[model samples]
Target chain A: MPQPSTRNRLLEHAEAVFRQKGFDGASVQDITRAADVPKGSFYNHFDSKQDLAVEIVHRYAGGTDLSPLGEGDSPVARLRAYLLGELERTEITGVEFGCLLGTFASDSATAGDRVREAVGEALASRSASLARTIEEGQATGAITARRPAGVLATFLVDALEGAILRAKTAVGPSTAAEEIDIALDALRP
Target chain B: MPQPSTRNRLLEHAEAVFRQKGFDGASVQDITRAADVPKGSFYNHFDSKQDLAVEIVHRYAGGTDLSPLGEGDSPVARLRAYLLGELERTEITGVEFGCLLGTFASDSATAGDRVREAVGEALASRSASLARTIEEGQATGAITARRPAGVLATFLVDALEGAILRAKTAVGPSTAAEEIDIALDALRP
Candidate 1:
């Protein structure tokens, strides 16, 4: 693969900075500094910090690896694999940073319409993905169908996001993992 | 009751401003302007923004009305009442603003140790309160003992926080209410 473009580099670094410092806390100058690109170059790529934020949400949402969920033999296994895969990603990002979607979601109210819409779409997509898998689980009799699959999917997303938030504040990733495990276990038939 | 003091007034207004704009987004000027107090008086009431944030977390945590949970006869009723009551509070705050504890939790990693600790303690207290209720439900055979009550409580808090985050991004409170109902239903034996 070829090297990432300057815009890509900015998105990559900006995502990390925004995750760590929040949308309001991370200035354009800070992102530029992190990307090792000139401040002027920022506007050359994205119109404003808000614009970059919407792009970042889109990029992060698109990058979620849902393949591991498909790899497992049973729906329960697939769901577990999916959630654990997410936990691994959280570990890679470090517990301190948490999930980008969640961070953005928390700040969405104050983040303006464009960013909020991006975040809303991103979360809705994620929940939909989870819901599809849950529907599969219900069909396979591996998960309870006590509630609608969409509701369960939303619950999963919420639990995972909540776990990530807790992990950010706690000492390590174990709290997050444990909390997630309980949530996944709750799905068992 | 007597009228709130100047410091109390600042704390109240500052909490709302911080909730609306986040800790980094809301500046001293905005907070003072909201409180209708001179800028210098801010320092007199609190050492710094971080100091005020810590106090806000404390006040918010202490003020959480777990009394509704106590009022219900069954564990499930108590849990539902507690969560619905929370939803009402969220409505009062407006879903756009989300939960203060969750908002702070998402920003905790970047918010420095004092703010992080305050948020952690506030969340932990909330989770513990929920856990005690869950434990009561378990003993009464109203909830399953499949997982430890503490883990279940954490899951509940996580799901609720996540729902609030979604509510902030979504069109209305119905999504939050539905998701919360599903999560509470999951607690059934």
Candidate 2:
């Protein structure tokens, strides 16, 4: 296959740096160095670090695998799979680095409104997707109707993000797995 | 009251700076500036930023009010009080700043082993304390025994941290409050 485009290379490397060092911590110089591209080339692709951050948020959110939420026979099973898939993805990406969306969200206060809004929108979209699944589960009587599906979906997202934070500082994925299990259990009718 | 100790003042300001700018994003200069002390004063109190960070984690963890977990007549009520106390604390501290332990934990991969281990220990201790309360709940028949108390405690911590992450970017505490309600609901026998 042909080599990756300059923009693709920058996005790929910049994501790792941002995930590892955070949006405020990672500078244009750092991104350029990691990408092995000159400093001048960065501006050619994105206007500012803030611009790059919004792009990264979009890229990361766009790539999230929601298929597990859609595929399983039962809503609870599908939700579990979706959450487990996230934990597995974090494991593959290196748990120590944690989630980019989480890291950015934590630092969004100082990162500017543009980046903050992008991260917010990305998370809202994820929550909406999960809400749809919960709605489906509620319709089938698989999940509890004590709370609105939208509310429960937001809770799952919050809990999953929280578990990832814990896993980042812990020994392995066991903590994350247990937390996800509890989150799914919370959804039972 | 007597003026706060210089060291205490430094820790207070440094925690806010770290929370807002992140560990990597905030430099010694920023901490000193925020603390209103000379750059030389920082060195006089601690060997390095990392040393100061370790102390901050200890202080934050120690200051966390687990009294709610100890006070109520019923185990579930006690647990609820404990968790709600935490949410209130986060609100007082400004959720926009998020949790310092969480903010540091996310960046631990590059923040060094000393900082990472200190944060990990702080969190582990907090979880242990919560687990003891959970065990108490289990023995009293106020909490389900379907899973180990230790497992449930860890999940509660994960979900709370995740909710804080969401509240940091959202408009108010409603989302965090709703999420916490669900987490507690999941614990019902």
Give each candidate's fraction of reference contacts reproduced. 0.69, 0.72
lDDT (Cα, tens digit) per residue for candidate 2, span A29-114:
99999999989898899989999999999999999999988885788888888988877877888888888889888887788888
TM-score values for chain B across all models: 0.93, 0.91
lDDT of 1 by residue, B1-189 (tens): 998877988888988998888888889999999988888888888888999999988998898999976764787778878888887887898788988888888888777899988888787888899899899989989898887887788778887888888877874334777767777766767
Docking tier of model 1: it is medium
Off by over 4 Å in 2: A1-3, A171-173, B1-5, B171-173
The superposed Cα distance between candidate 2 and the true structure at residue B73, in angstroms, equals 2.8
- Candidate 2, residue A175: Cα displacement in angstroms equals 1.2
Q: How good is the docking of model 2, by CAPRI class?
A: medium
Tens digit per residue, CA lDDT, model 2, B1-189: 898877878998998888887788889999999988888888888999989988888988999888888875787677777877888887887878788888888878877888888888887888888899889888978888898898898888878889888777764335887787789777877
